[model samples]
Target: MLIFPAVKASSRLPATSNNLHPEKHKDLYAVTEQVIARAIPLWNLSLTPVRLPLVSNRIKFKCPEYDMYLEDMSDSEGPRREDAKMSTNEKSAEKNGSATCRTSSNRNLGILSLVSVPPHLEDQYPIEGPRELKPDNTVDIWREYEEDGLQIIAKLANIHLTPEKPEYEGGTWHVEGQLHICASAIYNYDSDNLTTSRVAFRQQSNVQRAELKMSYPQGDHDFLEEVFGCEQGGSGVQDLVTVDNPEGRLLTWPNILQHQVQPFNLVDSSKSGHRKIPALFLVV
Candidate 1:
């Protein structure tokens, strides 16, 4: 439902300078524009956007910074009066209970010995039965998000590997974390003189599924590597699959999985190598 610019790279272009080479900058921008035009379609193919109702995108909700809402409640005086009445009732009950406990003999010592539980803090908002959420009957988060739309955060990175530093150490395992990132599209548009690099996806899996299919000694739950293909301690992370990040390859996956780039070296160690990538992360 949101109509905006296709991409903001054009808006984010650096300003021209008098000392800058104008012709070279012109060609650079021309190429970048063309690449972006081509990449938009691939981004469309990357993931299907789901309309999720997130707390950040909630409409027209606010909190008064200086107890202004409390001031408004004071003007109404209804809830305050009720609270005053309830406190008086609690004091009266406590006094009566103390009087009865003092008058009791050794035969009623059992009742006196019983601990008195404090009144629940939620007595102010008491309700019949459970006034909590029922799992079977759920409330829809997206009640009326008609004007909402998916948000995208874009990233562009250029990496050059020279002969002295031919091997890329790769990236650590992580998830994209801007505004509830749900999907990602990584397009490595250009690679030269580099070996094939890959991105591996991994996540915590349900070990109980495999546990139910087999019989084992009670409390002997050391099947982390045997069943889930991962070890215990720091060496183990459950892997699902890996996708190649070669030149002009567009790889996409949901952000539910943690991802990391695998190590790669130069195809020709004598020469330099590089890769240019533009990634788009989708948020809901």
Candidate 2:
């Protein structure tokens, strides 16, 4: 594990100030430089800190930039050009004059094809999976998170936090649409093997609440990584990134990217060791 030193946000010089001279803020500059030097290891990462009411209790690991350890909050900027690798079925179709490549559609995903888009329905679960998909009905609890959560994400990401669908179509935008809340009970060790990896809308599920979610400490199995070779830094995995799911941190990303949680060994072996996370899917 790579250990990165913590940097305080206050150490940095404020973006807006009347004083133009560096000498005026020399002390602030010195502290800012020191903090940045310590945080050098995280230079390649995009870090955003958010506090949800339920996760920000007196106890538990609480760090402002905890989201840095996780990845995939931003969308791919442009379409990637890849050499076409025809699958057996695709090759057969090509020979029979039934195949026509649509590079435009696949370029954004850096893959051959995408899964069927899930239908949009209010307060209803995604038809493709057996999981809870509820509305943002609990306004009191969610209201606290609105400004700090999606609003901050929107500002940082330069996305509109609109509830309606975005106008851009055909993979132009990765994160889009109004925010949706999904709550579900995580699987125990027995049912862990049965869980399927999926996105929020089969298209955009950014910012999933990952509190008390534990992964197997020691395991030789990662089906998505081993079988599909979908691990970060692997082939055909350029567009997607990996984030370590530390407790109380939120994982944000575009919905089009394929993601999966590796099955992990339970830290504690008891009925009390189950994990549940309420995911907040939105356009920011």
Q: What is the TM-score of each candidate against the true structure?
A: 0.48, 0.21
lDDT string for model 2 (1-284, tens) is: 11122233322333433332467756644543343333322321211112222221212221111111113323454433344455575467458855233222232232222222222431343334333322332222223332342211111111111123222121232333335422111111122212222222222212112212222112322322432334433444323344444443345443334445543333333322223333323322
Tens-place lDDT digits, model 1, residues 1-284: 11123342221223343333557667654544454445444444333222221211212111101111222345344332222222354357457753211211111111112211123523632332233333333322122122352345556788899989989999999988765776777788788998897999887656566455444334443333444565544444577788888887777776767899998989999999998887766556
Model 1 TM-score on a 0 to 1 scale: 0.48
Which segments of model 1 are wrong by more than 4 Å? 1-149, 206-216, 219-227, 231-236
Where model 2 places Cα greater than 4 Å from the true spot, the runs are 1-240
RMSD of each: 20.5, 24.4
Candidate 1 displacement at residue 78 in angstroms: 80
Q: Name the Cα RMSD for model 1.
A: 20.5
Residue 95, candidate 1: alpha-carbon lDDT: 72
* Residue-level lDDT for 224 in candidate 2: 28
